[model samples]
Target chain A: MTSLVADIGGTNTRVALAEGPGLMPDTVRRYRNADHADLTDVLTDYLREAGSPEIAGACAALAGPVRHGRGRLTNLDWTIEEAAIARVSGTPRVKLLNDLAAQGHALDQLAPEALVPVLDGPAQPGATRLVIGIGTGFNAAAVHALPGGLMVGEAEAGQVSLPVADAEALSLAQFLAGADGFAAVEEALSGRGLGRLYDWASAGAGRPGATDARAVMAALDTDPEALRAAETFVRLLGTVAGDLALQHLPYGGIYLIGGMARAVTPHAGPMGFAGTFRRKGRFSALMAEFRVSTVIDDFAALTGCASFLARTE
Target chain B: MTSLVADIGGTNTRVALAEGPGLMPDTVRRYRNADHADLTDVLTDYLREAGSPEIAGACAALAGPVRHGRGRLTNLDWTIEEAAIARVSGTPRVKLLNDLAAQGHALDQLAPEALVPVLDGPAQPGATRLVIGIGTGFNAAAVHALPGGLMVGEAEAGQVSLPVADAEALSLAQFLAGADGFAAVEEALSGRGLGRLYDWASAGAGRPGATDARAVMAALDTDPEALRAAETFVRLLGTVAGDLALQHLPYGGIYLIGGMARAVTPHAGPMGFAGTFRRKGRFSALMAEFRVSTVIDDFAALTGCASFLARTE
Candidate 1:
């Protein structure tokens, strides 16, 4: 039986069909999310172009929080409801999961090449796993092995107060106070966060006008102040991720996805990501047991959507 | 048809027989855990006292981490294995669970009177639940609903980096530089944590003799500085709880269990615990939807151990 899957993102929607488990899509299609009035239009367009195969089950990975069978996209104005989706797609079985949850479902389905090791540790099967996304925004969730299968719990962890350890806390406090006096993890970790960090460092050193993560990266290529800020950002991110790993006891491993993780790969090692991740006092040994990896494939969420549909069916 | 259940703590061991669902304490007995060399001696004593009834299944909840059918008590030097337990109790089936995990299992068995409300929110059945303990030490774990049933993940979150927001960061930075500064969340939130916070605050003010949570609580009864420190501890705890709630999306509810939670209950309402719990930046609405309650019954973990045996059988 064929099943329909869609991963809706801010800029585009990727839709596909799965013939069976681990089956790569015979035909892949993408639609500009803004071009359509709603998700219905996007699905309809995909169906028309793909010869409208009968879907036994349908699942959509949404880029927002899902509650009460509905979701409102964080980056878009679009809202999704189960009934509305079923009506638009003409499918009896429809389910919605957080995009990160879908990514978790796809973890076991990924090829070995899809994962790039960031830290070396044992990956034991049947252990718990943690998935984190740092791009656009910071979010993470824990996935565990349940009695019958696996389950994923989504988290709005980006806004969880960041843990400032040493001199860094003083620097961040001063920087945040200068820029409206309160800064969340997202304010300094996302694409916009990089720019903010750069601006703070530049102004602190009397060199203003630097903006954005890319510009900060450029500045870091030569400027010591920018380098320190970037270093601080990566270290803080690692500490936060380590805390999440401890909270979830993700001995199965930790997977870092999202655009920010990809961009900051170079800085992760130099910024003491490993040291910070394994720095859990007495439980440091347990944290050391957790293997950390970065997901290099951007299409992981799309594949996850397809995989989720296949499993539910 | 009957199974034996035991909840072994550092100080005491409570044992009971499950004639069926609830406890049959007519067939129950209690013993001091320290008096016995191993669990075998305790079981032998209990069985001998209870007329040595044949048991088909056995479950024991230990106040420590369990791995690979073995448990090492955190407070004591006792190490228990399922095989040794089965042999000692003459039971064919034996299962071991973390005391907190067992407490989570017993949630269904808890009567309404067993809980004291801290914050009110909707409780959705089958939603994920988060269990936190703040007593001698701070630890937390999340239970997720899966296809087969519920799975609990163990967390040593007390050792994770502590969340420091605004002035808290400055305090923590200073604390880190002190002799007792490198402490984790447990250092400030547990029974000992309360004492540590008092010590830090007193030292910060150039008066460093406060010791113990009891002393701290007594000083708070009269001294404004002491009260402020206690209030900060509670607020930071609430903030950490809120962080866990957001990370787990614990729609099932947030359960606060431990000696510290009980001790702070009277001061919780007056100290703005509710306000701090719901203070997550953008996810305040989501945080508000979680029901936060403190487990009032001292025997909650014991009851949970009984329930675990009942369900598995």
Candidate 2:
């Protein structure tokens, strides 16, 4: 049966049609939240443009919490209800999944080329896996293999207090906290967090910060400060990711996703991710059990939604 | 049907009999691990002393990882196998659980007086809960309500890197790291960690350190440095616990267990636990959703085994 799947993030929303467990590549379309008034409008416009093809079921994955058939985007002012989705799709078969959960479910469906290994280890077949996204915001999902289906545990880990061990990192956390006196993990790990790191570097060197995260990443090759900020971001990412690996015990693998992770993946090795990740006091050896990877598939969530619909049905 | 249950730790082993879902308090016996060779001897000794009561099943909970019906004590030289347990209890129905998992299962069975609420909030019944143990070593369990029973996820949380935010705390971590250059959460939050805190305090003030965890806690009333160490321990516990809360998203509550947690529970308020716990930047209000409590029951693991036997039967 033909199904509609949408991956909704804090920044933009991607809509696609799926046949069985496969996402239709050419049918995929992206929509900016700033242009669309609501998810319903985005869905309606997408459906209309695609010759208004009938969809048997619909699944929308959002970058936030989903409870009781509703999804509330964490970094956006959008609340999506299953009923609203049903009305727009002209079908009552609808489901809402946290974006991280979607990514988790799609892990198996992603092509080998879509994933790049950052840290190598044995990936257990059915062991629990973790999906971490660090783009517009940060979050994680623990994928558990259950009796009938997969159970994905959601976490607001990005909102947790920033962990600091190094002196300069501590200063950066303080700089980010400002008067708030509270620097969250998201403050140093997200896309905007990259900008904040760059700003911290500039300020430390007695200069006014002017560039955003995109500009900072683009200037990494030429700009020493940008390279330093990116290096710091990757190093801290390792520390945070290491803590998360312990928290979840996802021995299957740790999959990094979203824009910021991809942007920094190339620099992770040189920036000291492996060193910081495996530096646990007594459990240093245990860290080697978890393999780390970056998921470059943009339509992985769509694949997840399609797979979920097929599995549950 | 009668069942035998044992809660094995690094220091000691607790054996008890359960009739259906109730742990026979009078049948409970404590055995020092040093006195016995392994779990089989302890179980045999316990069964023989308990009048060799015929049991239908047996369950043993260990303070470490359990895999393929085998449990290994993390901080002890002990390995418990299900076959050995069956031979001791003379029952084929035997199961091995991680100590944290046992504690997780016991959360619902704890008596009113056995639990002391530290942070009050609406504990959503049947919602996800967490059990954190800070004793011989640190670990956690996530209690999930499944259709037929509970699914507990084990975590080696104590072995994770110690999170340090305060300047003095960072110094403490560095001190604790010593030449190893890695300070795990267990190194700062466990019973031994308390003693390390005292040692750090003494060294910082140029005083000779002379105390274990028990001696430090005993001197809390008169010794200013002892009091400060205890205070620092509580605050760090809060920070680590808070991180676990976000990692697990336990809306029901965070249950603190083991020796160190109970010892420092009284000073949690004045030591600034709640402040550090709830200081997650923009998610400060969201922190109010998690309730924290200290589990005081010593026989909770026995109850957990009994409950598991009954539920599975």
Candidate 3:
């Protein structure tokens, strides 16, 4: 059976026809969300282009929370509801899931080569796996292997209070706390978080600049401040990842996804990422027992949506 | 059919005969762990005293990690293997689970009166519930409600780095970081953690003394340092609970269980516990949606083991 699957992000929406639990990369089409009025229009146009192939159902992975079968894109001015999507796409069933949950559903489908191991540990088949998305934002979900099916519980870990251990990092934490008096993990771990870290480093060296995350990463080779900022970002990622590994105990593995993962992956190994992740006080050894990996594919959410649809059917 | 269930703790072993999901309080028995050579000896003694009922199966919750159907008591010189336990108890089957996992299984079995709500939120029938045990040590598990059954993923939350937001808490985090260079949540959140907090508070006041957690709690009315320490304890508890809630997104509820839960429950409301728990920067409202509660029963672990036994069969 063929089904329509879409990953609705703020900037772009990727639509594809899913055959069984897998998706063909060539069939996936990307459309700028700004080009469409809403998800219904987007689906209508995509179906027209695909010659209106009959789909059994449609599922979307939204870049925002899906509440009561409805989801509003976080960065775009469009809301997609299950009934509306089903009506426009001419599908019998429609499902909306948090993007992180979609990525969780794609965990098993990800080819072995698509994953890069940050920490090596024994993988038990029936144990839980965690999917963490670190892009414009940070969120996570634990995928539990169950008798009936996989259950993915979404997490808002980005907003959780950041753990600061180093005295140097304490200054950054205080600065990030600002008026709210709370330094969330996202403040130091997201793309904007990278820029903030660079600003802090530059300010500390009496050379503050308004460089963004991309410019900061580009300057890593020649600029000491940029290098320090990137290092700090990776270390904080380690802290957050370690904390989450403990919180979820995903012995199956912790899989990192999204754009920021690509940015951090290069420096993660050299910047004391795994070391910080394993330094869990007395249970440091136990922390080492959990594996860490990154999902390199950009279409994981689409894959997840397709998988979810197939599993439900 | 009656089944044997036991909760093995650091200092004592609790044994009971469970007819179903609930246990008869009159049938509960406690034994000092030090009095037995091993778990088999302890079980033999417990079964003999229980009039040797015709047990179908047995399940034991151990105060340690269970691996490969075996567990070694964290604080006692006893190793309990599934086969050894089955042999000793003469049960058809035996299971071993981390004590926290057992407590998680007991979440639904707990009577309404056994749970004290600290934060009120709508409880959906099949939402995830989190159980955190803060006793001589700390651990947690997220109980996912599955169509077929419940799935509990045990967490080593205690070993996760402590989240510090304020200057005062940062100082304590640094002090507690010790040689490990990390301040694990358990270092400041467990039973002994209370004493450490009190000690830090006393030393800061230049009136250091050998005061235990019980003594500090007893002097809360008369001692300024004790009051501050207790307040910090509650705030930190709130911080940990809030962080775990974000990590797990347990909209069902966050449940506090164990000895320290009782000690800290009184100060929770007055010491800005929920306030801190809900102070999640942008996701504060989402945090508020999660109900916080403390498990009041002392025998929840035993109940959990019996419940697990029944369900697995």
Error of 2 at B76 (Å): 3.0
What would the per-residue lDDT of candidate 1 be over residues A1-313, giving only the tens digit for each residue? 7777788887888887876545346666888987999898888888888887787777788878898889888889899887777876778888888888888988988889988888889988988899998877888877776654557877888877767766656577456532324345676777777777777777778886566677777777788877877887787777788888878778889999987788887778878888777666666677778889999977777677667666666
Q: Please give the TM-score that candidate 1 achieves against the real structure.
A: 0.94
Model 1: residue B42 alpha-carbon error in angstroms: 1.4
* lDDT (Cα, tens digit) per residue for candidate 2, span B1-313: 9999989888888999898889989988999999989999998888788789888999888888899998777678887899988887889999998878888888778889999888988899989999989887788888999887898986778877777676776788788884557778888788888888898888888997967898999998898889889988887887788888888889989999998888888888888889878877777788899999999998998899888888898
Output per-candidate TM-scores for chain A, rounded to 2 decimals.
0.92, 0.96, 0.98
lDDT of each: 0.78, 0.87, 0.86
Q: Which tens-of-lDDT digit does each residue in B1-313 have in candidate 1?
A: 7888888877778888875557665665778876788788888888888788888788899878899999988888888899998897787789988888987887877889988998888989898888898887788878766655556778887877777666664675457432424447876788877776777777777886657887778787686667877898888888889878877778888889987888887788899888778776566677778999888876677677667676666
Backbone steric clashes in candidate 2, count: 0
- Fraction of real interface contacts that model 2 preserves: 0.65
RMSD of 2: 1.6
What's each prediction's TM-score?
A: 0.94, 0.97, 0.97
lDDT of 3 by residue, B182-275 (tens): 8988888888888999888988999876577888889999999989888998988888888888887787888898898878887889988988
TM-score of 3: 0.97
Best candidate, DockQ: 3
Model 3 chain B: lowest-lDDT 10 consecutive positions: B279-288
Which of 1 and 3 is ahead in TM-score? 3
Residue A135 CA displacement from its true place in model 1, Å: 1.2
